[model samples]
Target: MSDRHFSHEVWLSKLRDHLTEERYAARTSRQCIAVARHFLRCLDKQKVDVSTAQPASVEAYLQQTRRMYRRRHGHPTDYKGWQCLHTNGIHMLLRLVQGLWPPAPKAVTPVEILQSEMRGEYAQWMAGQRGLAPGTVSHRCCEAGRLLDWLGERATREELATLTHLDVDGYLKYRAAAVGRRSLKDVTTKIRSFLRWLYMTERTSRDLSSTVIAPMLYAFESIPSALRSGDVEKILAATRQDCTQKGIRDYAILMLISKYGIRSGEIATLRLDDVDWRQEVIRIRHSKTGAISYLPLLPEVGEAVLKYLQDSRPKTSFREIFIRACAPYRPFRCGSSLYRLVRHRLEAANVITTGKRGPHAFRHARAVSMLRATVSVKDIGDLLGHRAADSTLVYLKLATEDLRAVALEIPTGVKA
Candidate 1:
C-alpha cells in the first residue's frame, strides 16, 4: 500500500472504525485519533512510511517534539506527562497500521511454547470427551499451564512421567502461599485431574492423581454474603436514576439477577430469543449445570429489559441481548464484566458489603428473601436452577429468621 494512502483524513477514519470495533467511547476515540493524525503528519513530513516505522524512530520523534515544546515553555514540569500523549497516539496508530500488514509472531519462551501445546491438547480432550464447558476447560488449561511452568521448561515427556510425591508436595506448598484457601482448593483439583488424565492416556507409568490430596472443605464453613432487601432496593434505584444508555442496560441486568437468581454467566449468554413475550417467561440455560429452565418474567424485570432493548441497545446482528454499551457493540467477552457492573452500582449506591461482590450476592439475597416469605426449599432450588438440593443448602446459613424462630428463649435478666 502507498504511504500516501495513510493520509490524515483516511488514517483517522480507519482508526475511528478500529476503536469502534474495540468498544472505545466515541469522544475518547476521537481524541486518540486526533493525536494519531498529528503524529502521522510528522512522519509524512519526514518521508517515513508508517508500515516500516520502528519503535526507536517513534521514540526519537517524540523526544524531539518534547524538546521543542520544553524550549518554548522553559517549564520544569514532568515531560513524561505530555510524552505519554504522543506514546499513546503512536501506539494506536502503529497498532492500526500493523493490522493491515501483520507483523511476524513474537518468539515464545521454550516453557511457554510447551505449556501452550499441552494446554491446547488438554482443552480439546476436556471439551470433546468430558463435555466440560468452555469456561471450565479454559480455567483447567490455565492451571495445567501453571503446573508445566513449575516443572522445568526443558523437562521431557519421560521426565514428566517420573514426577513423584516430592515434586507434587513442593508445587502445592508454593501454590498455597500464593493463593487463598478457595483458590488453593481449585489448583489442587485441577492438578489431580490433569495427573489422572496423563496416567489414563499412558503418558505416566503410575497413577499420581491419588497422591495429590485436596484441602478439606467443611459444609457451610463460610458465611453467605446476602445483601439486605433495602440495600438491593438501593442498587436497583441507583440504576434507575442514571437514565443513560449504559444505565438502562445495567438496570435490566440487575433486575434479572435480583428477581430470578440467575448466574452472571447465564445473563452474559442470554439472547433475545430467550425471552418469550407471549408466555411471559424467560428461559435460562445454566452454564454450570447445563440445564434449561424457565421462570415467570416479573413485570418490573420485563419492563426494564424492554426499555433497554427498545432504547439503549445497539443495532447489531448479534443475537445476544447484552452487548458492550460502546462501539463496536459486541457481546461481553466473559462473565466478569457483569460482576464489575454490579460492583460499580453497589459502590455508587453506598451499599455496605463483605466477601463476594458479584451477581452471586443477589442470588443469595433472592434465596434468603424466598425463605423469609415461607417459600418451600424445593421451590427456591428450582428458582435458582440448582440441579441438586445440596447446592441450595448453602443459603440456609443466611436464613437468620428461621434460626431465630428455632432458638430457645431465655428468662429475663438470666445470665449464663
Candidate 2:
C-alpha cells in the first residue's frame, strides 16, 4: 500500500464503512469509533496534519493516544470492558493508519516475527495437540497476548534474540504493578513455556530456562472464616422456603458447596451423567487441571442434587449439570453464577462478612471441616484432585489449632 494523507472525516468514514461491512458486533463497532475519534483528537493536539504525516508519524500518534488513554482512565485493574476499549482502540487505530499509509517497509526483528508465528502455533497446539479445555487454552492465550503487548514497539525478532534476563525481570515487575504478584507469575510462566517451545523448535539458541521462576507460594490468607452455624441454618431455611425452581437450584448448589467443597467452576460444568447414584459419586469434568475427578457424594449432597435435577432444573439441550432457572433458559455460563447464587443466599440469610461471599468460601469451609476431622493433607489433596499436595496445604493454616493438637511433642528440658 502507498502512503497517502486522508482527511479526518475521510478516515472516520472509512472506519465506519469497514466496521459496517465486516458486521462487527455492536460493542466492537462502538469501541472502534471511540478509538478512531481519539486518534483524530491526538493528531489535532499534536498539530500533525494527517495529509502531511508519514507512516512513522501515524505510529507515533497511536502511541501518544495510548499514553493519553492510560493517563485519563488509569491502568485497568481487570481486563474487562474498559480495558478492552484501550487495547481494541489501539488496534483499530493501527488499522486506520495502515489504510492511509498503504504499503511501507516496516522494520521488524526476526525474533518478533517468530514469536508471532509461535504464538498462533502454540495456541493451536494447546487446543488440538494437547486437547486442553477451552477455558484453559483461552487463559494461556491471554497470558501470551499480554506479554506480546508489553513488548510493544520493541517486539522485533532481533530484539527478542538479544533479550536479556533484565528484560524478563522488567516484564515481571511491570506485571506485578499492573495486576499482582500471582498474575505476574502466571503470565511469566506462560511466556516461559512458549519460549521453551520456541527453543525446541530451534527458533532461538538461548535456553534462559534458569531465569524463569515459578510465582512465590502466596498463602491463602484471604479465605473467609466459615459463617456461624446459625447463619448456615438460616441460609438453608431461606432456601427451603422459596418455592421457585431457581430457589431449589440455588439451594442445592449451596448445599453441594457446603457439603462437598466442590469448586464453583466444577459445579457449573456439572452434567446429568456426572452424578452416579449407584456409585454415590459426582464426577467433576474439566476441573482446574483439565482432568475429570470424582467426589463421593454425601447423603445430603446427593439428595439435594437429585431434588434440583428432578424438579428445579430447566429443560434444555445444554448438558450442564446446572442451568438458569429463568426463561429462555440457558446453562450456567461461568462460575460467577454460583458466586451470585451464594451471595444472594448470604443476603437472605442475613449473614454479614467483610470480604466477598463467593462460592469458594464453602470450599474453604469443607477443607477446614476435613482438617478438623483429622484427615491427612495428602488425602485431602487427593480428594480435592489437587495436582500438588501443597495446593491443599492452605487448609493447614486455616486449621491452626488442629495442627497444633497433632504437633509432635518435643522434650523441652533435654537438649540433644
Residue 106 C-alpha lDDT in model 2: 41
Q: Distance from true position, residue 11, model 1, in Å? A: 6.5
Cα lDDT tens digits, model 1, 197-286, are: 888877777988888977888887987898989999999998899999999999999999999889898999999999999999999998
Clashing pairs in 2: 1-102, 1-103, 109-157, 110-157, 111-157, 112-157, 270-321
As a whole number from 0 to 100, the lDDT of residue 71 in candidate 1 is: 92
Strongest candidate by lDDT: 1
* Candidate 2 lDDT score at position 184: 67
Top candidate on TM-score is: 1
Candidate 1 — worst ten consecutive residues by lDDT sum? 98-107
Supply the TM-score for candidate 1.
Answer: 0.80
All candidates: CA RMSD in angstroms?
4.6, 10.2
Q: Please give the lDDT score at residue 384 for candidate 2.
A: 70
Judge candidate 1 at residue 337 and give its lDDT.
77
